[model samples]
Target: MEFYSFNKENGKQITKFNSNFVMSRIIQTDEAAHIGCMYLDKNGLVGYHQAVVPQLLLVLNGEGHVRGENDEYVRVQSGDAVFWAKGEWHETKSETGLTAIVIESDGLNPSAFMKLK
Candidate 1:
């Protein structure tokens, strides 16, 4: 329904659309998959949340950190891509502004944004 736009909710920094926080429309309901791009500003944090479908984090620029439901974190830099499973609580933290592409697709994949329950 809604397209991509700036996101500042979740205790995170402002996320730009298309250039930063851009997500594709959901193709499947039962599967709950979505694809999009994202950016994280310095000291930005996206509070814990779930995904509608499986998420693939592709680093486009800058550096940052991602926190999972397990409280585990992974260091990320440009040209790096990470996979975040759907239905799993996760959060993103950035020290400096970061730009990345997020792909949410596949029937087996669901975005935490949709399935927050």
Candidate 2:
């Protein structure tokens, strides 16, 4: 069992993200799972990117908008969750600031599940 807190201030910042956004990696495992937090200050934006693995983003505070491959943007707020499939291109931005949790798992696949006989 593991116990941890998602303290924004304690996390290490990821320099790979766009200057308009802040990303912190909280946890990464050999099992191909990783967890992180993203913060977008007012008027901040994350440029277009593609997901190499399945990812889920859960809003923890504030609000933002996300755009997918279709180029359609959708509003998101605290408590909302968004899913991005592998290879999907997406981006995010906030006019009023936003905080979110990001979870990614490259090893999690439907084929890994087995049915009991």
Choose the strongest candidate by lDDT. 2
lDDT of each: 0.59, 0.67
Q: Write the per-residue lDDT of candidate 1 for residues 1-117, one digit (tens) a residue.
A: 112222223223336663555343222345554556786888878787887666666567888878777776777776555556657677777988888877676543223333211
Q: Which stretches of candidate 2 lie over 4 Å from their true place?
A: 1-30, 107-117
User: Which portions of model 1 show Cα errors greater than 4 Å?
Assistant: 1-33, 107-117
Q: What is the C-alpha RMSD of each candidate to the true structure, in Å?
A: 12.4, 12.3
TM-score of 1: 0.58
Using Cα atoms with residue i matched to residue i, what is each candidate's TM-score against the true structure? 0.58, 0.64
The window of 10 residues in a row where model 2 has the poorest summed lDDT is: 108-117
Task: Please write out the lDDT profile of model 2 over residues 10-117, one tens digit for every residue.
Answer: 344655745443343333445667888988899989888998887767678998988888777888776566667789898889999999888788753322221111
